[model samples]
Target: MLYRPKFDDLYRTYTRAFHLEVQDSYGVASENEQLQRFLGGEPTTYPEDWQQWDAFVKEVTDAGASIQRLRVVTEPHSDYTRFLLHHTDRNVAAGEYVRYLPRQNVSSDAYTVDDWWLFDDAVLAFSIFTPDGEWAGGAITEDPVLVGRCVEVRDQLWPLGIEFETYLRGQG
Candidate 1:
């Protein structure tokens, strides 16, 4: 999932948490334990080279490249759908690096990480899977048009800077 060309610029590289490149640890992720579930066996499988995918994410974190995160798109009434925005927002606040994408034109499809199509258009899709086949997902988009819009949103959030806490307070 991570090896796709769409993810090239997003992830840096790696050699002991820095971009050095190696044989075994090519596509490993450095974010945290959550990424482990994404790499687990079946029910959730991907067409791309998982090794390359790991390398890509590891590189990105090592290089300090910005990551754009989107909450899972879902039906407005669905419980998962309702949790999407808040989940994405909370993850970002933790500095794990994420962005809540704009709503999609399509309706929710109930696709899980096991569904390859979910990560099909993804620039970089790295995640963890639970035994029940649920995925702790983090998808990155490299679509030029979408990237531009995401940057705009990030810019709006950037002004809050060290004072984002106060800004969030006001919004509350």
Candidate 2:
């Protein structure tokens, strides 16, 4: 059924975990420290939580599960995007395959919205967020039609995305 599982458990439970990110920014309360540090111009630190997340990614990937994310960002980028770019290195280091696609490059006619996670080509969890970027909840489902759509969307746009490092370098 549809349910919110622990982040680490996502990797453990599914053979493939795919995430699509459409937001220019997120105002998750848990990310406040990192955001503040980023805004303050402090050097990035690998905090304990960061390390744990990294470990989870590595463990999952090492165990042969794929963890991937596709982030669609607008060109000229938002401040939050820059912050996210800075932190993306950690995501890569942790063994997740991260990519970026410029908003202009993406054909809007193909997709209506963003922010969803697909697990094993079955479960789909559409994320909801406040206008201010605060984390809300997800609308989860397991309908085959929706699952097919998620797979199609992932296939169509994922290859068009630039790999994490390549995207950052191009931004410079």
Candidate 3:
């Protein structure tokens, strides 16, 4: 069986990590409550898990490494996507570079790729989601061809993504 390292392990080991998120809504159990709160017009406080992730990002970036994420979202964002947009400033404050691109802007071929995280431009970790958008698990590979393609996609999309604040302002 191929070994799948935990996300924390991958983040700690790689100096440069880039994430591409394509889902409009994710069914992460941990975030369901918060999403509901947002949808109901209640204030959604940052949960402990989010705080922990922010701290981790701060630590990694402080050590001279980098963590960047590009979210490809549909226009007229889904409820979950709006929830994410509302909270992304916390991620930015903690040293993660977050950007967004409208789904229409992506090429057909690029849009077919699943969400993934590339580490040090060497390893590729695919985020596997069920048809309903629930987190299933992930697969990690070091195959050069796969990694190269992910790298290429990252390079292609990164330039097109608008910075988080800019994108958020346009939404308002």
Candidate 4:
């Protein structure tokens, strides 16, 4: 969640990618809603200007990257829906190109937002997994099984949005 950019010494080198898995529980929901309320609808403006989601959307859109969203819920929806709807609006408001796919499935396990720290890329990616066990602490790679499991979960959801070039075309 932290980084140092580079060159102009602006510390914008936050080439971090984030991946997290979600589970059918209230833990993540409560925390996420709390965060939204705490930030007072400025979810994309926290931390700093570089942390601004507009910057992220611009970077990816200008470079022509794909944004795929996978839904793990069925008939009923969850709080995560807010993320999709709001961010989609965010992209359009900024005139950024973004393609999103919504899918339904059944996945096991939950994770903390901290799980997204594994991400680091120019085309920055986020693989979110709802973590178990009381939302673990800071980024800790000491546990590979948990890390590997998160990656495995993401692979299953990747195909839902494979046509990057084609997906970008639909974006304005």
Candidate 2: where are CA atoms >4 Å away? 1-8, 46-49, 130-137
Tell me the tens digit of each residue's lDDT in model 3 across 13-111. Answer: 889999999888777778889989999999999867789889988988998889999999998889989999999999999999999999898775874
Give the TM-score (vs. native) of candidate 1. 0.30
Write one digit per residue (lDDT tens) for candidate 4, span 1-172. Answer: 2132322121133332333334333344434544466447554432233246567645654554433333343224344444443334554544333333333333334323322434322222232233543332233342566656556555555554323235335442
Off by over 4 Å in 4: 1-18, 21-51, 60-71, 78-83, 86-104, 109-117, 120-143, 160-172
The ten-residue window of minimal lDDT in model 1 covers 15-24
- Model 4 C-alpha lDDT versus the unseen true structure: 0.39
Local distance difference test values of all predictions, in order: 0.33, 0.83, 0.86, 0.39
lDDT of 1 by residue, 34-135 (tens): 233333421322223434544555455456544433333322323323322223334344333432222343222321222111122223233434454434
Per-residue alpha-carbon lDDT of model 2 for 52-139, expressed as tens digits? 7788888889999998999999889887888888888999987899999999997885554878989999888887777767646677
- Give the TM-score comparing model 4 with the true structure, all chains together: 0.40
Best by lDDT: 3
Q: Quick one: how many clashes does candidate 2 have?
A: 0
The reply for model 1, stretches above 4 Å from the true place, is 1-63, 96-131, 136-172
- Model 2, position 53, has a per-residue lDDT of 72
Cα displacement (angstroms), candidate 1, residue 149, comes to: 19
